[model samples]
Target: MAGYLTTHVLDTARGCPAAGLKIMLYKLSGNSHRKLLEVVTNDDGRTNAPILPAESFETGSYELVFCAGDYLRATGQAGDDPLFLDEIPIRFGMSDAEAHYHVPLLLSPFSYGTYRGS
Candidate 1:
């Protein structure tokens, strides 16, 4: 089977899926960052489809930028001025081209965490 990439976000503070959050995918090489695509989370806190599909799967460095501040503000969880957690960027390396990569974000207004999920 071929590989692909998928992601999701959960509002830990609200204990629910983070719907409507914007996410950006980027391909990185050296000091250059190339945008792959932009997508919004659905009601299930997941993209409608794999962000990185099997046909385009690659083994390299990639980044996912979650627009947490916007989501926080929309949910009335953001504070005044600057947010402690704004655009959360998670950089990771995919070494296996034939593996399914699931990255999930556990987020709150003040903090966040991520892990390689199934």
Candidate 2:
């Protein structure tokens, strides 16, 4: 078995999956970040496939940028011009080469939370 990365977003304000949210994956090295890929959440708030599949899995620092502003605006949760929470970036490191990593975001217009899930 090999390691891979997965993620999802939930709209806590609406109590539903954050469909149509855009997410970007980046691998960080020192002061630079190399974009890996960009994906959109489906109706289930999940990507159609793993963000980092085993074929290209790596053990290092990575970031997941969730386009929370767009989702908030689309869902009419954003109240003003400047949203309290916009693009949410979560940075983490993968240590095990043969492990599965699941990162999920729980978001609202004013706040957000994340965790490493199974």
Candidate 3:
């Protein structure tokens, strides 16, 4: 089972796929962090391709930064004041290189949740 990384974002407030949300993937080692890739969600609220393609997938710590605040503002859902949820960074570890990693985010203007998916 070769490994890969994928993500999906759902706009809880609008009850639809979080289209146009920005996502950034980072590879973290010790105190050093390196940006891997950046992508935007499609009409299905998912990347056109995996965040980390199979060939580039590795067993290590990684981070996915979701720009929730900007999405909300662009969609005309956020208030003018400070946002409760901004760039939502989900840090996770890949212990097995041969496993599929699906990180899905359930998001709203004021709150968000994420979990490991199939």
Among all candidates shown, the one with the greatest lDDT: 1
By lDDT, the better pick of 1 and 3 is 1
Clashing pairs in 3: none
**Candidate 2, after superposition: displacement of residue 51 in Å?**
0.7
Error of 3 at 59 (Å): 0.6
lDDT of 1 by residue, 9-92 (tens): 999999999999999999999999999999999999999999999999999999999999999999999999788999999999
State in Å the error of residue 25, model 1: 0.3
How displaced is residue 10 in candidate 1, in Å?
Answer: 0.3
| Model 3 TM | 0.97
lDDT of each: 0.97, 0.96, 0.94
Please give the RMSD to the true structure for each candidate, in Å: 0.5, 0.5, 0.7
Supply the TM-score for candidate 1. Answer: 0.98
Off by over 4 Å in 2: none
Which 10 consecutive positions of candidate 3 have the poorest summed lDDT?
77-86
Q: How many clashing residue pairs, candidate 1?
A: 0
Candidate 1, lDDT over the whole model: 0.97
